[model samples]
Target: MNRFKAGEHEGVTWVRGIAGWSNFSIKVFLYLVDGVLIDTGPVKLSGILVPFLEQQKIETVLLTHYHEDHSGNAPYLAGREIPVYINAISLERCRVKTRLPWYRKVFWGNREAFSPYPLDEKLTTDSLTFKPVSTPGHVFDHRSFYLPDKGFFFTGDLFVTTHPQMVLNTESTPRMIEDLKTVLRYDFSTVFCGHAGIIHRGREVLQKKLDYLEDIQGKVLHLHNRGLSVSQITRKLFPGRLHLEYLSCREWSAEHMVRSLLTGKATAENPRPRT
Candidate 1:
């Protein structure tokens, strides 16, 4: 099934997309401010997304990253001659189609290829000045946008939760910690998270996430120094696999979360049976 919801706050328009069944559904949010759209919701919900886009007077589109869930609708907007922007690192990669595993294709759907302009250091409109912030770690090409004057921060996938139990094999928890800290340095009151939706007292929420990850990092490293293997340390801290981990065929797992903190590298391994 597909789902869509629309709302507004602080003059920013947000649309949510849900793809899946009941509580198992995956969701992503698309935000629009000052005629600029941030992060296109996944392609799976394009039925609703398309009509919504048709009604908006979008002046520019800004992608927070190249992830399928975030960049899914770029092609739709680009075909209409609307200016789309992304980080330079993914500017060329997005020009070609994105390949995904079976599960990802099921959840987010496949993203079509489209050429996008590289993001400028800062973006401005008649009403607001937007600053493009380099906030990697969720993915190397990830970024966040900030509205200094309005105290609004648009965090892509950077702060999905204060404590994430499962992460993609490609993600780095340690690097993500740094990314969280990097953004916390800026003054912001409200956060527009891609998955969690609007967050007030945003700085406090981000700080908690940073603190949680840092504590996890300390625990993972302490256990590693005691001669614990990655698997051993993983079990010690984030034992067992989540349903999503099994669904993704181990592409997303607690073990990857531990490994990222220990060495910032991900290794391919089968999920150990839960004890």
Candidate 2:
């Protein structure tokens, strides 16, 4: 019943962060290194993971990002006093949005309940040997962690694996795209995204995500140039996707995908949904 399972890879145990009681939703992480627990999940499902942490005698818990699902279980993780770490940006965003990071709300349609917590440690360059790679666009504070020895990149939301396409969400930002391009040059083999899946062969998935992103952005520009309104573009080209509820949320996930095709914005400007 508990989807919280750990996998051993190159002598390191990687915990698959599963959100939601039923279907897989978000991915939180727990990395143990020589007795230090890197991070904890943000929800109660993370409760299932506690046994694993206790068994390992983990003494520290670092946060990859401060999103709700990722850090929701902090209260539960209090026993270990697993000192959490985040950049100033992550700290501020957590206070404002009341969750992990911003784009996550955009991508998943403002999912999960909120729980705000202050970061116990602000990881500065001197404190962490491995620098946090600033990868925004996804969210203003989104960062990718790099381990020089293992060639690991803990990418929170930078590398997503949502099937044919990640239902275009208003959360998509120019900053996120720019960060992705910057990460491509790094020498990392795996990326652990904040949602759905993990990419072991980072290069292939990275290339596809980039190419697909660029292609769709261009498609959006072309359709906008054709004098198509947001609603017209969705009706004519993305009819099947129009029914997705995530698009109808306050962030207008998929709706933004179409609106991007027009004004590069998702607003009520779209003519009322066709009857």
The candidate that achieves the highest TM-score relative to the unseen native structure: 1
Which residue pairs come into collision in candidate 1?
none
User: Candidates' TM-scores?
Assistant: 0.94, 0.72
Residue 230 of model 1: what lDDT? Answer: 85
Error of 2 at 32 (Å): 3.0
Tens digits of per-residue lDDT for model 2 on 143-242? 6667655676677667665222334342443444566788887887876555544567876787787776676667766776898776675566545642
Clashes of each: 0, 12
Error of 2 at 184 (Å): 0.6
- Tens digit of per-residue lDDT, candidate 1, span 1-275: 44788888989999988878435876788999989999888888899898988999899999998888998889999999999999987877788777788888878888988999998589989989889988777877788999999999999999988888988876788788888888989988999999999999899999998988889888988999999998898888877667888888998888877888877754432212121
Candidate 1, residue 143: how far the Cα is off, in Å: 0.3
For model 1 the TM-score comes to 0.94
- Report the Cα lDDT for residue 81, model 1: 93
